[model samples]
Target: MKNEVQVKGKFHYRLIGWKYSIWVRLLLFLLLALIFYMSLYVKLVPQVYDIQLGAVSEKTIYAPRQIENAVATEQAKEDAAKRVQPVYRVVNLKNDALIDAIYDKLLQINVDEEVKFDDKVSIYRRVIPQLISELENQSVKTLRNSGQYNDSLLEQIQQGLAEQQYQLPEEAFFKLPRLTKEDLTAMLPVTKDIVSKLMNDQILDAQTARAKVAELVNTSNLTKNTSRELVTEIVRAVITPNKFFDQKGTDDARGQARESVKPVYINKNDVLVNVGDVITEEIYARLDNLELLKDKANHLPQLGLAILAALLSFVVFMFVRQSTLPITYNNSQLVMLILIFLINVAGMKIISLGQNMDYPYIGYLAPMALGSILITILLDAPLAFISSVLFSLMASIIFNTEHMLLFDFRYGLVSLVICFVAVFTIQRASQRATILKAGLMISFFSMLTITAMMLMEDQFSQKEAIMSLSFAAAGGLLTVVFVIGLLPFFEVAFGILSPLKLVELSNPNHPLLRKLLTETPGTYHHSVMVGNLSEAAAESIGADGLLCRVGSYYHDIGKTKRPSYFIENQTNIENPHDRIDPNLSKSIIVAHPRDGVEMLKDFKMPKPIRDIAEQHHGTTLLHFFYHKAVKQAEEEGADNGIREEDFRYPGPKAQSKEAAIVGIADSVEAAVRSLRNPTLEQIDSMVHKIIKSRLDDGQFNECDLTLKELDTIAKTLNETLLGIFHSRIEYPSELASKKTGT
Candidate 1:
């Protein structure tokens, strides 16, 4: 039976080894890349059409994926630029300085009393022309080096100043000489005030400014008509156009307006043209820019997508290779990971199809947490975290509807939040129902994330917000359904022993456990004690405590075959080992490990449980039967030929930390159980002795049990055993109590 079990176990190992080969791993990665490529192919490389400009449309065309409508975008930019009004800059003409110079010239003429009134008038007129000519020439020279001087600019300046050169008429020249010094002094301030006020305002045309000067002067403090007339003429001569066309400022403003106009998009499934409509230049250009034209098909997007797929596959491959998780070493687990990725991506793709209905929030219903939750429960949480980020990235791309954008960050952010929430909430899941709780957590966080994204938009739509929240909540519930439905398939197909499965196996009502309990109650009780010891010890070293406990429940199942022969189930019956030969008794004792393995295999127990049952004994000698045979041989004075190897159980040794710890716990429990009220010292000594014996025998060499971990296990076992077997106090007898009462 042992040989037969070994051969079957070897066949199983060979099958697993074949799947774990290097070529198989490479092929699995290739398949993963292929799945990514196929899922995104249509979105990346849209269909092209065979239509021409000005031709009658044969069929209605819609955008296959989100793309920027370059023609429409440019037109929008042009419209925005056109809407920007022309910029005008106010030019400082220094009109106050010109008015002050005119007043000073009049003062100088008034001070020259040596001339006749007619000669003074003639002199005033000549000096006014000279001062105006000199000032205008100086103004032109000042603007020449200012970089604003051009032939048209200079011509505009001359035209604007044409009103300023009011030739003092013969009548006005005579009026200016008649004015007294007091009149001239009062007129100076009025003239300056009117010119300054008019220049301070934006004077686009000098003629418009001159028309307002007379009214302003009349309203001033100048009461004399001649003084008012002189001030009006002087103020009018100085007022030129202060506002000019700013060509550079206007161009910059238009450029800014153009830049401020966002690009127009042809969203996925948006109609580009309708049937029976002529293919105008605008529509033809839009199709051509989108690369929808037959001869203008662009393959670069597809190539870029393929490269991205390959890169993602390579990153996953490298991560698995470098990961310390036990499942990462298993090719079957790698295939399962890829399958989970595919399922999540497919879910995103399915939801993305709703984009055609013009529902942009449909991506919120993608069940983004499904893959991370499954991974956290079935595999490792750290692996699930890394995979969650990747899934979010894929979701962003798959659900994108924005023109010319590779990813929609709104979807990515929501997906990332939900995926992380699912992983954290379900990492320690011990039951299938825990997935539902995780889904609720994912849903709550997803709604918050989606709401945050919506609030960031320029405009908020209550209907869209409500739809997104509904989809997010539904997605969480949907994830729970998917996880519950798919978990069993993955567990069964891959022969995985998740925490939920371990919890189920630990139940005492299991068939093998029930058989052990009914047929060999003492051994069943011993196994339970061993499970307690093993679980505490395994947990001390961060091993799988539940696995150790479940394995211990069925470890002694083979004892049910001969309950009477095992001393634990002997009860009041005669000692079967004393009546039988020592050699036969040794054979009976050593056969249990092999028999237990066979029974477990028949029951389809997981490989970890089977390994524990098969390797827990680990070739340790049955000292009682071996010592008894040696004594019998010495007394008979004949060679019994009792080889020490023949008394030991055949084993591959404990192959894992949990198995090693279980073996030590099994030995420690049996040794302590035989003691009559063992003390803490005795229990501590027994636990250390068992562990030390195994360590010295090289039984721990096959596993990764370190000396420090073993010491920790021994301390934990000693503490647990002390709790179980602590001393109890005795109470007084009834006769003594009655004598004391009398």
Candidate 2:
């Protein structure tokens, strides 16, 4: 089951390795874009209309822009309506002519000479009633056309005649009164003048015309109330509305007034309404127009933001692709890069939630530099800088409240400055203290940026600015805290030997190094010598010298398990290999590399160190033991089990330049240490021979080292060895003789 699980794990890693390609990377970018789109879509998009009037606002709302301007646009229409004057058409001319016609008919009746006196009076009353009826019918028709006719006036006249008991063939009257020429003549002038004056003036309705007619007759020259009453009835019928309303003109005036109103604008960040204020219809409509309502599903802005996120993702992809860092091209590194970006964005989003609170500046409290520092430590500082830009942009968007589309550059600028400071300060960090120091520098820069931003603002309270500055400083420190906390997890999980970890491992007080020193001092000294040579060679080739140096320290830890068996640690002791069979000696020699790997693993050392320890020998032959075994078997005439392959170190060869360089340095250091009073020429020859032997044996086949780099390493190692094993001058003979004589 254990073996099966191990096989499964291997297969899983193989599948992951296979799937980690350009397509996977593109998909991850797409996923990142999706994350950004989802996070920012709502913040950027216009919302649905969800607010209700007379309800307490669940959250504080700021005007996206000047909304009162739009409201004033609509209010202008109402003001225009109020400004419009009522339109009227002239009907007074027609009314005046009708009055004159009635008066002329009355005069004709009064001056009649063709009838007897008593018959004239009867004839007059009858003719007068008929004439008035015909005239009233004509006047009503005219008034109707002008929309000013009043049938009620005509009805009142008939009712008044009935009240006086005056009856005629006219069925409208209930009764009629006896009439004389004197009564008719007295009323004729008074009624005509009163009707003419009332009609000539503006009379918008029948009621006003009647009131004027009644008042005129009460003060007229008539002696009897009956005569006055009869005149009022006739005049009231003549007094029709002279002014008719003009619908088209009135509408035009109103429209012009509405057009005259200038729009009122509400400024950005202006409070539209208070927390408990009732949402008026005008306010609601304005909010809707501004796309500030929570329930509105305006999608165009969301689409725009999605496009923006995709564009940013594309930029990130292109940036990574163009990066010179090898990790940028590696599948694992790509995964780590995306993971770091997402984590940073997620943290920004969490911090952004506080932006909705009373103290919106709390968003600056987020540790945006966390990812920047991590990127600087785990990857390259340049990539960290780029990531800082992206993170800052995201922070600005996520925290923006004043406007949906407008970026809050205040937060973005601060984040950028702090992140850059963190990355820059930690660029060459080689110890854990460096990260903390970088964080402090980041905090200092952040405070400066915050102060600059506050001073730039036109309106800011000193208390608020100071508080925000403090939060910004704390944000930087928090970033360091997160970076420190997360660094170990990534290192352990990825088996990455970071510079700080390498430095830590190189300490002499380390348990494995201590053990090697006490148990196998010769091997310990040899390892130290190899570390120095490898570090110098790696530096000459522009490789990771620190890693090379540290890897060399633990490369021969396996030999500590059997110190006496190894020639380096066999001080004042006889050779154990001579007493043992040649096959046993070869087995013991080859076991050291494997033993070192196990010991390193048991101590939970990083993979690079274990790899160097295991691959340094790189399947090279234990030539001395192999030849002894072969000669012994040949003498016995049984060389079947003495193949050269059986006496070789089991190795997968060097996989990195550091490992390969350490391997060469390890061999060179051991060979040079074994030499007695070695000359510079001899040391140079020995270093070249060992390198040539390794090259011929194809030990560097799996590594990426070039022949040119190998040549440099050879030259570097030869020079370093010459310095370590240079010949001593015999100059003290004269001094020694002088001291003896004394």
Candidate 3:
């Protein structure tokens, strides 16, 4: 798979560059967009029913002037009861009884109705015939009884029958016997000239003629007929009730006016609203029947909202495209991105739910986080911040008002901030507990944000404040949980060695470490000293000090296999180095690193530690044996037969910061241990000599160790050695007695 990627891909498996893929950018855009969208959708989609949050403020909802009317209604009922005062006291008909009557009326009225406009004439044809016969009778009666047929008398009967008239769409009016205003105005040119521009082809210049009529068409020149017509059109356009408004829908049952019996503070004479009159869908649709453009404009706000979301998505995608982030997203990220897009589109589509729940504002946090966590863990904090900003803008559309927007912005800002806090604060070496701490921090910030929003909204009514505060707490705590839950999966999937994982592996009881302690106590003790020496040296070089210490602890486990053969374990010992050939002894020493790798493998130690134990010695020739062998071989006349290669350990060299530090510490500790009554000069010399020899042998070639860093390492080793093996004034006799078991 890697070979295929390398052969065909542009920047093949760059441990650093996979995060900047266009796919990642696109996913980020979609994820943020979806979060914005879901903020809208969750409100609408969940119950498929509006959770009516009646007007919290005076501005948003229309109020009825029913207080005085209700009082009058009650007074009228009281007057009737007073008329019956001889028998009973006045009764309250405007309370429970009014509610009951309304409920009964509601049962009788089924608005699940399909209004038929086209079949109107056909359905009412029979009534029309009867109405015509009645009108004929009335006309005959006017002519016969009154001794003359007057248009006025005949009009009275038509007026009486008008209440039974069947109304239909104005388009159908063309098929009726109605007189057109043009017919009357055309016959009356004087009136037409005064109120309208009459096109008379006989006039030469149409423009001049229109200008001439325009002057006469001023308000002063309006004839009674034209004035009446003007008033009619104005009334139809403005004063006529919008059919969509159902006045009943505006009835505030809990308003002060409805308290007890009368709506408080409102003057009865000032009342204009009546029962069964309101702004409803019927009123709007009827007005929509007259104004084509106004109806079309109604949907524009929602459409504008959608466009805003898309624009935000574009901006976010562009930002993500330009970023240099650090996470490598998996297929799941793409899946999450797709999910967000779907949710955003769905949310926006059902934005009517905003009346019940602020989906765009309240709903955005979850999906945004779904993307944000991936971004923080895989990429970087800045990208998550960009994503949050983008998501917030997109959310504005979901919430058409600032109140909804506040909540939406808070969710995004907090989510992004929390993601940064979680990712940047906790390293890979951290563990599950860190996630909880992060959650607490997130919670703190969340509560602060909620408090701020509440104070700003000042609906700081206990209920509202508490509700908002709870949501903030939930969001913060949940973010921590989300991060914690996701860490382990990413660590295993990506083979990431976060700081947390390293810390856990550093435990002394780990199987490999335990084996080294039990099997090679002498080597173990040596390793501990080397660990102390190397950790300080590594820290001075700004290397991973923990890795240095841990590596040194397991560097020489192989020597345990033949403890007697090694000098360190020979207590009260024989002079094996004196008795054995120098070549044999050198071979035994060189073989241990190789043997250590085998032991570590058998113990199932991780590969990195095994490499350190095997490669710490590198390919450096043992100078002591080389000189001795050269002397012996030259004497035997076989000088070329004994190659320097056989004397060296078969090594691949220090391949990391820790390995190199271990090697340096190993040589320094041995040299320092060899000192008898050594002065500070000798310790400094030993540290520098060992480092210079390793540098000359090219042991550090594979490792990234600089000269400046090496110098710091030498100084650190010298100081630490002096401290550990420092000479001191003899203790007093009482402490000395304890030391001697006296």
Q: Residue 423 in candidate 1 has what lDDT?
A: 88
Ranked candidates, highest TM-score first: 1, 2, 3
Off by over 4 Å in 3: 1-407, 427-432, 474-482, 563-566, 573-588, 598-607, 631-637, 727-742
Query: Candidate 2's residue-wise lDDT over 70-148, tens digit each?
Result: 6566876796688678865554335456556655665564466664556655654566556555655565455556554
TM-score of model 2 (CA atoms):
0.63
Residue 429 lDDT in model 2? 88
The parts of candidate 2 lying over 4 Å away from their true place are 1-22, 50-296, 324-329, 356-358, 454-460, 633-642, 722-742
Model 1 clashes, total count: 0
Clashes of 2: 16
In candidate 2, how many Å is residue 490 off?
1.6
Task: Give a tens-digit lDDT track for model 1, residues 241-310.
Answer: 7676666677889999999887776777678889988999988887887778886777788889899889
List the global CA lDDT of all models: 0.82, 0.75, 0.53
RMSD to the true structure for each prediction, in A, is: 26.9, 35.7, 32.0
- How do the residues 509-622 of candidate 3 rate in per-residue lDDT, one tens digit apiece? 887667767766667788899999988988887676877777788788888777767656777878577777878988888988988889877866656678789888888788
